[model samples]
Target: MAILPICIYGQPVLHTLAEVVTEFDKELHRLIADMHETTVAAPGVGLAAPQIGIGKRIFVWNYADQDEAPAIGVAINPELWIIPPEPGQADPEHEAEGCLSFPGERFELRRSAAAKLRAQDADGKWFEISATGWFARIMQHEYDHLNGYIYVDRLTGYAHNEAMRIKRKRNWGKPGLSWTPGIDSLEG
Candidate 1:
């Protein structure tokens, strides 16, 4: 497995909706392996196919809670459902959210506290998973990428403006912005 270069926010590939994965063959498995390696190298909680310039409906995520071991898996052609928080449940601290594509940025984006996801594994076996808290956040973030949406797109008002300002300053929303893990400085 090789660590692939992550596409920055400006890449057109990222904005395009990813195609569904129909062939569960060796090529798909290899892509999943590379995605896992790239995600780990990015040191990110999750990554989508589009983030790595692959327009296939796939993603890899690794998230751990204080009480559990890390949950790592690949999701192909995933279908997600956002579950509303319990009555009186507090909202998530949106400021803590970050994306690998938008590297050095964080925004106050709202998302459900829990989610239900149905997806196929690398071998084409299907499974369902329920996630909450940070895991749910990661799921939503990666799912957005499959639909050609970014976390920043969910921001509003002042927060949205601030995110755009940051992008413009770094020329990230334009085409051809490049990134090299461990070498590029993403100082925001």
Candidate 2:
């Protein structure tokens, strides 16, 4: 397996919505393998195709609790169904997160506590899974990339403040602060 170069935040490919994989061909499999290799090399829990300059709807993630060994797998053409937060439902707490695309820049982001997802496996077999906690957060983050969304878009309040801090550090000494308007705002 090869380690692909992850496209950074300013790369145009990252902002483009990925195309669904119509055929589970050798190339698709190879891309998944390369993505896994790259993510593992970066010591990241998840990665998406667009992050690696591929405009395909695919992602790889592994989320095993402390006790169990991590289980890594691929998702192709994934779909998500978010359960509505109940009345007075507590917002999910912020967690420090790092993207394969933005190495050495970690920030806090809040996401749903749980999510229901449907996607195909490496063999193009369909499956549905419900995830919560860290697993859920990782899945949601990677899935967002397929739809041209990044983790920074989900931050709120103090979480947004923390993200700005990290962003400034990452872009220290740069001419001007580069920001994505809608994404930079804390309001969701």
Candidate 3:
């Protein structure tokens, strides 16, 4: 398995909705393996096929305890539905997030603390799941990739401006720098 070069922002492949994988063949297995290797190499919790320029409806994520190694798995032709934040679950705060595509850059973005998703396993077996906490965020973020959405789009108000500023600065040769948007600017 090899670590694939991730497609960064502005890549046309990333903006296109991924095609569904209909066959669970050796090639599919190999792609999942390569994706797992790539995700670990990048030290990310999850990854999607579009990030690697495959444009397939596939993603992998694991939320096992930090002490335990990640359980690498794949979702083939997955579907996701966002669950509305319930009473007393309002205002999920922003979390600092990084993407393999956006190397050396990070942003503060708010995401749902919970989600409901359904997908097939590598063997084409169906599964339904509900996730919460950081795992939920990871699922939602990666799921967005399948739909041609990036984490930058999840940011609101000043956070969006801050991410753009840092993105520009990095393109202009700024490195090893971190950006933090003012919390007061976040919308509820």
Candidate 4:
């Protein structure tokens, strides 16, 4: 397992709809392990295939509530269902989130409070999970990546403007930009 370089906002893979994972072979398992290693190294809650320049419907996530041990797993060909978020502007302080693709930037975006996800594991076995709070947020965030979206694309109000400003300042939103975790100063 190794820490893979994360694609930045401009990468084409990060903007394209990821393809489904069909072959559960050694290659698939190795990719999942590398993704898991990279997520832990980045110290992020999750990482998606597209973020690592792999256009497959796969992601790895690690989460732990204070009351429980860490839950870590790979989701292959995921299908997510989220409870619609309340209608209103997102709370800037409490709702802020960052993406590995965007790295080091956080912007507020309203998201569902609860979510139900159905996906297969690394071995192609199916399972389901219900998540809330930050776990749900992680699910939604990674899911968006598989669908060719960056979290910044969902920003609204002043946050949306701020995101655009940052995008322009960084000269992002094009292609071929990326950063290696541990080596790069940027973190998400």
Query: Candidate 2 on 7-102: residue-level lDDT in tens?
Result: 666566677799989988888888888888777766688989988778899999865662222378788899987765344423344567777655
lDDT tens readout by residue for model 1, 1-188: 88888888989878999999999999888888888877777788888999988888998987766232237788899999996545432334543688889897777666788888899998889988887777888888999999999888877787789888988888788777757676677775
The number of the candidate with the highest lDDT is 4
* Count of clashes, each model: 0, 0, 0, 0
The CA-based lDDT of model 2 is what? 0.72
Predicted candidate 4 versus true structure: per-residue lDDT over 135-180, tens digit per residue: 8888899999999999998887788898888878888888888888
**Residue clash pairs of candidate 1:** none
Question: Candidate 2, which segments miss by more than 4 Å at Cα?
Answer: 66-70, 84-94, 157-188
Model 1 ranges with Cα > 4 A deviation: 66-70, 84-95
> lDDT per residue, candidate 3, 36-60, as tens digits?
8777766688989988888899999
Give me the runs in candidate 3 sitting further than 4 Å from their true place.
Answer: 66-70, 85-94, 172-188
| lDDT at 142, model 1 | 96
Better of 2 and 4 by lDDT: 4
Best by TM-score: 4
* Worst 10 contiguous positions by lDDT, candidate 4: 62-71
Residue 6 of candidate 1: its Cα lDDT? 85
The model with the greater TM-score, 3 or 4, is: 4
Which is superior by TM-score, 2 or 3? 3
